[model samples]
Every structure is written in C-alpha cells, then in structure tokens.
Target: MDPAVLREDMVDGLESDAKGVLHDETVAVAMRDVPRHEFLEDDRTAYADRELEVLGTRVLAPSTVARLLQPLDLEDGHDVLLVGAGVGYTAAVVAEIVGETNVHAVDISRPLVIEARQNLARAGYGGVLVDCRDGANGFPEYAPFDRILLEAAAVDPPRALLEQLTDSGRIVFPCGTQRQRLEAVSADSEREAFAAVSFDPLLVEGEQSGAVERNRMTREDREHATRRAESRRGWEQEWIEWEESVGPQ
Candidate 1:
C-alpha cells in the first residue's frame, strides 16, 4: 500500500477510535500530512495505532499522541516545545501544525536526539530543532512557548517547563507512576485531568545513562529492578507540595 493511503487510513482510524481525542481540524491535517513512517524504523506497521519500541524508547501510539496534543490548542505560527521527542514523530506532527521553524524538541538520550534529528531532516522537517539535553529543564534559549507537550509520564508538570510558557500557554503531560492520568496544565499552575494513559516515566538526569549501564545486567535482574522502580509511590503529594512552595512565578 502507498504511504499516503496508509496515512489516510491511520487518520481515519484515529478519527473513529480517538474517542474525542482529535477534535481540531488543524491537528487532524497535521497528523495526515506528517509521515509517521519516516520517524519509525519499520514502515510495515507504521500506521498500526500501537506503540512501537524504537531507539530503546517507546514511540507513543497515534491515539495517545492525539490525546496528549488535543488539549494544547495548537495554531499556526505558534511556538511549541516538545519534551520526550522519541524519534520525533510527535514533534513532526506538531511541526506540521505549527511551522517547523517554531517547534523545538528535546530528549534526554543523545542517541535518540541524533536519530530524531536525522529522521526529521529526512522527512523534510529539518527546520524543527531537536536538542540533546534533560527535558525536565525546559529549553531556556527559546523561553516562553505557546504550547508545551510532554510525551513521557511525569509525577507532575516540570516546574521549569511551566515557567517557560507564555502567560496563556498550556502544557499536557501524564501524571502518576502506576496509574497515570493525562493532564493539561495552565501557565498559572492549575491542572485538569483529561484521560487515563499508560506512559513510561520521564527520564531525568543520569537515568538515561543508567539505563545504558543496566544493559550489562541479566534479563531477570533487569526485570526485577524495573518492578522495584515502578512500585515506589507518593509522588503526588510531593509534587503538590513542590508546586505550592515554588509555584509558577
């Protein structure tokens, strides 16, 4: 099948299976125009509305991407900051909605950042900036973005990202560890839960590096470590206190 046909089919699926996740025409058009196959290593299942693991990170499903972006209210010429730009598929979609020149994406994994850059460039979106850095610390050089989308799950919206938004800017991210809720946060620090989603936690400084080290461990040991890491709780209260104390100024 032609890639265009596959893309349209994917869009059709998104519209039907989206469950109100894709209400904006701009977002729909962007999703249709951006070639998801380019960002993915495998083009055969590119349109399958399922998450595919790439570059040691999972690229979110199209439905999940729509859920994360629908609330941001993106517009042409809007500046967007995309956190956790795994392979740049979401960023490419955003670049199509907002101009490529106006979109900046960051990832904690340097290799992923490089791959994302190559993928975006190959897909004719070289203008979209892909940076290798800790996503928790928002890209300050381009402070004050109109929309910020965090593709990874976090306990709460990053304090730095909130501060980097324009007064009316909005951010969407998944909150919680085991039971995650997709949340949209306003510049004023108010948050609203929209949908439930399962996403990997945002990698912090040194976590990505640590993941590289864990490759040497046995499979069973790695599985055991992962379970232990996921079982820890109480991030919600900690996030609330942190928000109250340092709130968005």
Candidate 2:
C-alpha cells in the first residue's frame, strides 16, 4: 500500500478514536506528511497505532504523541524542543508543523540519538537538531523554547526545562512513575492534566545501563514481564512511596 495512503488511514483512525485529542488540522497534516516508516526498522508496522520498540527505547504510539502535542498549540516559526527523541519520528512530525530549522531534539542514549539523527535526515528533516545529552537539562544553548514536548514520563516538569521555556511557552509531559497522567504546563505555571498513560520513566545519564540488559531479553518475555511489573502491587506501592518521598514539589 502507498505509505501516504497508510498514513492517512492512521490519521483518520486517530481522529476518530482520539476523543478530541487530535483536533488540530496542522498537526494532522504534519502527521500525514512525515514518513514514519523511515524512522523504524520494520516498515510493516509503521502505520500501526501501537507503540514500537526502536533501538531499545519505546517509540510512543501515534495517538499518545498527538495527545501530548495537541495542548501545546504548535505554530509555524515556533522554536520547539523535543526530549526523548526515540527515533526522531515525533520530531520529524513536529518539524513539519513548525519548520525543520526551528525544531531541536535530544536523547540521553547516544546510539538512539545517532540513529534518530540519521532517521531525521533520511526523512528530509535533517535541519532538526538531534543531540545526545541528558534531556532533563533542556538544551540551554537554545534557551527559551516556544514549546517543549517530553516523550518520556516524569514525576514533574524538570526545573531545568521549566526554566528554559519562554515566558509564554508551554510544555507537555507524562507525570508519575506508575500511574502517569499527561500534563501541559505553561510558563506562568498553570497546569492541565489529561488522560492516564503508561510511559517508560525518563532516565538520565548513567541510568540506562539496565535498559540494554532488558532489551537483551526475548521480546515476548520482556513484554510479558513489563505487563506483570506494571500490575504488581509491590511495584505500584514502591512508586507511591517514592512519589511521596521525592515527587515534584
């Protein structure tokens, strides 16, 4: 099937089932134009609504990406920062909406960042900057972003990212370790929380060593283990306790 047709099918599904999460026409066009297959090893599943693991990191589902982006109200010429550039698919989509030169993406995993860079270039979005760094600290060299999108889950907007936002900028991220909620926060500190989502917690430098080990496990087994872990009472309690101890203030 033509990739463009498949992309339109995907966007149509998102619009139909997203429950208003993907109402932006500009975002829809961006989603359609960006070649999602170029960013994944398996093009067969490029149009699937489910998330896929790329280079050991989970690339968020298209609907999830749409939900996170919708509240940001992206516009042309806006300077956007994308944290957790898993495979650059999301960044490419954003770049299409807000000009390639205006998008910057960062990931802590060097391999992922390199691959993302290649993927972005292959998709003709080479102008979007893809950097390998601890994304917790927003790229300060390009201070004051008009919009920030963190693909990974965080307990709160990192102080550094919040500081880097323009006075009227907005940021969207998934909060909570276990029971995550998509949140959009403005420079003025106003926040809006949306539907629950399950996302891999954002890891910082020196914290992703175990990710390699986990990826080494058989894919089916790994997925089963992940499902079990998310459902385990002890795991939930641990996150609750940790949140109580050190969650965002």
In order, candidate lDDTs are: 0.85, 0.86
Clashing pairs in 2: none
Task: List candidate 1 segments past 4 Å from native.
Answer: 17-20, 209-249
The candidate maximizing lDDT is 2
lDDT of 1 at 143: 85
Model 2: CA > 4 A from native: 17-21, 209-249
TM-score of each: 0.82, 0.81
Question: What's the lDDT of the predicted structure labeled candidate 2?
Answer: 0.86
For candidate 1, lDDT tens digit of each residue in 1-249?
Answer: 788999998888778755556777888999999988998766758888888887678878888888888888888989999998788888998889889999999998888999899999999999999998889899999989999998888888889999999999999988899999988999988888888899877766667743555332544576898887777666634444766767789
The sequence of per-residue lDDT tens digits that candidate 2 reaches over residues 1-249 is 888888999899888854556888988999989899898766659888898886677888888888878877999999999998888898998998889999999988888888999999999999999888889898999989999998888888999999999999999999889789989999999999987888887776666644444433445576898898877885565546765667698
Give the TM-score (vs. native) of candidate 2.
0.81
